[model samples]
Target: MSKLEIDFCGVKFRNPTVLASGVLGVTASSLKNVVKNGAGGVTTKSIWLKEHAGHKSPVMFGTDHYFMNAVGLSDAGIEKAEKETFPEYSKGGRPAPIIANIVAGKIADFGKLAERVSKLDPDIIEVNISCPNVEDELGKPFACSVVDAAAVTKLVRSKTKKPVIVKLSPNVSNIGEIAKACAGAGADGFCAINTVGPGMAIDINLRKSILSNRVGGLSGPAIKPVAVRCVYDIYKATGLPIIGTGGILTGEDAIEMMMAGARLVGMGTMVYYREVEGFGKVVSEMEEWCRKNGVKNVEEIVACIS
Candidate 1:
């Protein structure tokens, strides 16, 4: 195996850098482009059981330090994914594994999406129960409650034979407790600390909110500290591997995340900063760091923090 290779819940990744859900994840060509540019794996945008329209344009904005978005989990549904995305991704022989990220407004819908997407057979299925932008339509996120989180986990787990990783939120009081609850309900693994804060930003000139939805989740360099903490807590609580996400923009940031107990690091806004080629750039930087630090296997750094 290459030094950068990792086995996350039985799925092998060429490297630990994966395309975070909702970036350029809408189509097969975009996801494959991410792999071609050196991402270890790709996750599709949140797929619903049926078509779901997202927020209007002006859904996102970014600054040097952070990005705020309220895309509202837009997706064309699983049928389109099965008919176009999965088949097209497979047509190219799948340079890297695909993780289908599914979201729903209710528990039963989560199960249905899970069952349907399972048939398409993406290498992994990520249960997105923690999105912060859909609260107006769906009430609070499932990740906010231990019982609800576990319920979603149990239902999704029953629906799919594939490894199920529950995406988590950072807005909770004790993220560890929630992680433990999901683990008890049969979650194979987790992707910790999705975006943070359903915060708002104003357009000073327009004297109005920037996002059409008024507020959105905060990501980019600002939330890395929270993501690291959440990953550490989840790892300590369950000893389960996590895909550490939020605010990672460089190789050093990825290493810090692994040291905080992530088996893989997911990047979203980094794409905005460095483009697709940033994946390869991050990987090269990681190799250089390992070489200079006398680290042989990159996995050796996973949870090295104590």
Candidate 2:
């Protein structure tokens, strides 16, 4: 059998295939189901300090090749995960290590949330600094500024002993500088890139935008190239462990991100389309490709572009 094991930021994963945070990770039942179906790791949906009902209906709209959603960081809150949900996973022989993704409106809130969730004993805490769907008076997403990204990450790092991975927004003009700033502030790793622009699609008939928020972050194959470039750039800049996500639908797609310097690859939009079992199929195909190329280990392919 092909060895898919990879060590990312001191945590060992059976393979590099992790389920990205979002709808796929909202509930414990769904997380167990995906683990049973074969994800190496699963990141919980982006939780906040308090519960959020999220946006109303029409938050998601489908396109021919991708999707746009403005979920507004709706989650069950960090305390629930720390006190109740995580215990369930701990009881069962967890199919894989869990990474908790979290977000907060204020910088200090990041530290408080991180401190609470750290007690849950997850393998990693992913600081969600790049959620483009939520907007304030800032004119751009919260993570669009390097200072905000670094400050939040720094505060969270001070509160947790666990590995801290900052997820970056692709909407930013200078992703590399933002990434370096996070690393300097004590982030152990990074996940690039979050969904692309807060793009809009209007309903010609209704004369209104499709999503409830009027604009939403885009994901799926349409944004893969942009994601790939972001990962490659950050990899070149920070040399930190990267979890690459965005537009990965097939084994080849996953491999593309790995070659762009992602230590681990996250599958999101594809899961919504193919369901959980699709992860196994992608792993199998990746194994075959590895054997054909005489690659003994998956890590050898990181940044191996010719």
Candidate 3:
């Protein structure tokens, strides 16, 4: 068996590096390209029930320390997934596992999106109740309230037989409590520490907020500490598998996340820092680290810190 190979929620992954949702838009060809570049799996961008016109352009900007965006979860909806994305992805026998990420503005809509996306039969279903950009319209993310998070989890769980992994937010006070609620409601696993903050940046010269949306979630190398802490907390709270994400830019960062109890490392902003080939690069780096440490399996490091 490969040192990096892992079974997450009954699904086998060639490696633990997965393309986080929202980096590259959901296109079958683009996703396939990422896999070819060496990602063990790919997650679709947040899929709404109907086409969503996200915030107008100027939605993103970045620096060496951080990346921020207020893209607002725009998507072409489930119709596109059923008719175009999934069909095209399956055309070539699917190079890697696909995690279908479904989102909605309402709890009921969550169930509807789950049901429809599940029928398309992606390898796993990620329920995105934590997008921070749309708080103005949606009135705060569902991940903030344990009761509401559980509600969404229960509804989505009932709608699909596929593994249901809830994407969590880092903006909360006690992420572990929220995670426990979801676990009780039947969540199969979790993707912890979504972008941190609905933060903003101002162009000193322009004298105004950078993004058109004014505020956005923070990503890139800056948030790795927060990601590690959240992953550690969630693991201690539930011992469920986690996809640790946020500010992961190197293979060492991936190994650090695994030591915090993440079964897989989710990366999005790394694409911005290292390009698509970063996946293979990080995987190779991980292997080298393992060999140097005399570790036989990558899984051996999971939660080793505690």
List pairs with backbone clashes in candidate 2: none
lDDT per residue (tens digit) for residues 9-124 in model 1: 89999899999999999899999999999999999999998999999868998899899999998999898998999999999488998999999998999999999999998999
Can you write out model 3's per-residue Cα lDDT over 1-306, one digit (the tens) per residue? 238898899999999999999988569899999999999999999889999989987988789899999998888888999999999999959898999998998999999888888889889999999999999889989999999999999999999999999999999999999999999999999998888998999999999998888899999999999999999999998899999998888889999999999999999999988999999999999989998999888889999998
lDDT of 1 at 251: 94
What is the Cα-based lDDT of residue 66 in candidate 2? 88
What does candidate 1 score on TM? 0.98
Write candidate 2's Cα lDDT for 192-274 as tens digits.
88888889999999998888888889998899999999999899889999999999988888889999999899988887677
Q: What TM-score, computed on C-alpha atoms, does each candidate reach?
A: 0.98, 0.96, 0.98
C-alpha lDDT of all candidate models, in order: 0.93, 0.86, 0.92
Model 1 lDDT at residue 254: 96
How do these models rank on lDDT, best leading? 1, 3, 2
